[model samples]
Target: MISVVIPVHNEEKNIEPLFREIVAALEPLGEPFEVLFVNDGSTDGTAEVLRRLKERDSRVRVLTMDRNRGEAAALTAGFFHARGEIVASMDGDGQNDPAYLPEMIRRLREGGYAVVSGWRMKRKEPLLTRRLPSWIANRIIGLVTGLRVHDNGCSLKVYRAEVVKRVQIPHGFHRFIPAIFGVKNHEVAEVRILDRPRRFGRTHYGLKRTFEVLRELLTIRFVLGNRVFYEKALLAGGLISGLLAVISLLSSHRPFWAPGAFLGGSFLFFFVWHNLRRFNQAQKEGVFHVRELEI
Candidate 1:
């Protein structure tokens, strides 16, 4: 069984076509599948369309939140409700191709991939706003998290049901899901997917959202880089301690080596303090309480 999760926000016009395409693409696979439409408080006719679709097809399920809780929350709901052996997520803006499902499933099975991410090598978005920021973000993320995925913003990603069963996702951290699992020793693979120009509503993202994603990216990187940072801290502490021991043993006058020992202690203290500041900053912001969930 396979479960497809679609997160939609004000995408009324694209709902029907996306639903039909998913059905057409997945029906021929000769396996049981379910498509979950997570309506993230869309103000358009999206809710009505989903209700109708669910009434018509038993395989179509809708999880409507009381208000817009962003993509991460929506995806979390879908993941909890999904009951397939393989769980997948895609955007509801009609950009991600449903035709790629077969190949994605095949790769997940054959390659023993815990997560199969879809890479859109050729994008139809603008160069500066979308592509440029995305490119910079991908590179920085690759450098930081050591996950060299080309398209971290791509929504066409599939995960094994067992892998995502107890998974927890923070709001706005949806873009870095692969890296989150990747650094934890999960086997994540990528494959090229068709990126079609969206024919429905306009893009909901803006420069503000991009900046927010970048901030979150840095936080994720810092959290993942803790091991190396701590190792360096420990190495520095050990070397300074050993040097101080030797200096004290060989010193004719205590005053000469005392300053160097003080300096080493200061360096170690400053290094640990700086790293602590970063760790504190990486902590998640604010609090969240679920108002309602129909999952």
Candidate 2:
């Protein structure tokens, strides 16, 4: 069985169409499947539409949130309940095509990649509104996490059941799941998928959401900070160098001025000290413990 989980919010107009299209597309796969729709506190008629669909199709299940918890939270909830060996996720706003799911699954099964992400080759949304921010986000995240993906925000993503369960997701961290997998040494691949223009309600995301993405990118950097011992070493070295420079300048025995060589030597000593501290700490606490400290 393949579990397709979609997180929806206030997309009443597109729900019926997307559901019908998904049902049609998955029928030929010859395997039992389930479509899980997570209703994220939508105030519109989306909930009623999903309820009706669930009534019509026993394969369909609805997970309702008490309030709007964002896409990552909704997806996480759906993941826990998904019963399929292969789990897939896509947007519920009709922008992500269900027709490409077969190819995604094929690649995952054949290529041995743990996750297969969708690459929106040509987005049909407004250039200024969606495309521009997405491009900026992709590049910035690529630099930060070393995960060079074109459409990280594209919701048409597939993952192995175990891999999906292994990852930790926070609010708005859905877009960076690829980056998370990169650090964990998981094999990930992508395939091109069709991007449809919105047929009904306005976009759930906005400028504020983009800013939140930048903030999260910074957070991933901080979360992975201990992994880069050289950076912490440089910081510690710079601090000690600055302190030594100040001390040498004020000392009476010294040549009335701070010596550059002395400052450099001090910085080097502190830099080694910092690296040792980090290595010893990592040995004591373990790198996996990082997930426990929600920094």
RMSD of each: 7.7, 8.1
TM-score against truth, every candidate: 0.76, 0.75
Q: How do the residues 1-295 of candidate 2 rate in per-residue lDDT, one tens digit apiece?
A: 9999998899999988998888888899899999988888889998788877877888888888777877877887787778999999998888899999998999999988888989997788778878899999988888888777777888898888887764445566678876654434357888988788888998887777886786566456544455456456656666777787887877777874466766876766554455444434533443221010010
| lDDT per residue (tens digit) for residues 1-295 in model 1 | 8999998999999999998999898999999999998889889899888888888888888888778878877887788778999998999999998999888999989988888888996788988888888888888877777777878899998888877654356666677777765434358788898789898898987677786675565456544556457545655675666677577767787876675766677565455445434434323332122332332
Using TM-score, give the best candidate's number: 1
How many Å off is the CA of 10 in candidate 1? 0.7
C-alpha local distance difference test of each model: 0.77, 0.76
Cα displacement (Å) at residue 146, model 2 = 1.1
Which candidate should be chosen as best, given lDDT against the real structure?
1
Those runs of model 2 whose alpha carbons end farther than 4 Å from true positions after fitting are 182-186, 225-295
- Poorest lDDT segment (10 consecutive residues) of candidate 2: 286-295
